[model samples]
Target: MTDLERDHSEPPDCLSIVSQVTNSTRAGKRERLAGAAVRVLHEQGVEKTTLADIARAADVPVGNVYYYFKTKDQLIEAAIEAHGHHLQTMLDELGRLAEPQDRLKALLRGWIGERDLTAQYGCPTGTLASELDKRDDGLDRAIAKVMGRLLAWVEEQFAAMGRTDAKELAVALFASYQGVALLTNTFRDPDLMATEGARLERWIDSLT
Candidate 1:
């Protein structure tokens, strides 16, 4: 795989190839499957997405999906992991800002940058967790950890700003993002992202 495709939540050495019967080529196949899973799941959602659909999208045989992912849930987990890697990469980039408040605002702006995609598919993480929650699957916990990383990062910023209520503030901030994302998707309005992002920046400035 190319450098563009190789980064994962776990170290490359530690990433598990989904197919139990490891072969020279299976690793590449697994990567393709995981990438395809993320895209298909985002576009099609959990209920409508199927292993066969992912396989077709990947240009692999339908049976190969079973070889890579015994169940759709396993594929979902891989997609979540891939998303975690992407989120952490973004957070790391934002962390380079000299000010914590700037970092927080940058994160919100980053979401705003995806306004088009968010309008089409919603917040990828939020939508995945919500759909999984409706199904009563345990996968929501995995998403919780992904979200917790963001909340904890945000809380750290608030705490650094000397807010004793940092944790509550973080939750409120995240809840706003979730709500905005829902409305943005439901109404298919990119303007909601711009409006909410502006409002969020104002709130961030008030964090002092």
Candidate 2:
């Protein structure tokens, strides 16, 4: 058999690769799958999205999805991981700002930047977390960690601003964003986020 053919004949590994996979190739496909999973799951939701849908979205073959993810849940978990990485990256970028309050307002503006997408599909993380919460499959915990990271970072910002009730303030801030995300999507109104996001920025300023 050709080297390429030989690669395909090997038994599937733990990640479900049925071929002899190079690290780079494997990582590339896995990244593609994770990225696709995030967008597809966000647009269609967890319960409604299929591996095939993800594959199509990723432009990967349907058979190849099984090579990277044994099940849809696994792909969903990968998407959550991607979301966490994205959240961390954003927070890290916001950290460059001089003030905690500026960081918090920037964070609000960042969400406002996604007003169109949020209005169409709801908050990507929020919608996915809500959908997964209906199941007992434990995926909710993974999403919770992503959320926990945001909450912790927000709490840290509030603490830096010298708020005694940092944790409670963090919760209230997230609650407002999440509530508006739901309303934005339900009403298909991008203005909901824009208006609420402005109010939130003002609220953050008031807290300072």
Q: Which candidate gets the maximum TM-score versus the true structure?
A: 2
lDDT of 1 by residue, 1-208 (tens): 3563454433242446543245554556666777888888888898998788888887789986666566778778888888888888988898899888898899899899999999999998889888888767778888888988978989998888889999999999889998999999999998999898999999999766
Query: Which RMSD values do the candidates have, in order?
Result: 5.9, 4.9
Candidate 1 colliding pairs: none
The local distance difference test score of model 2 is 0.87
lDDT of each: 0.83, 0.87
Q: Tell me the tens digit of each residue's lDDT in model 2 across 142-164.
A: 99999999999999999999999
Per-candidate TM-score against the hidden true structure:
0.85, 0.87
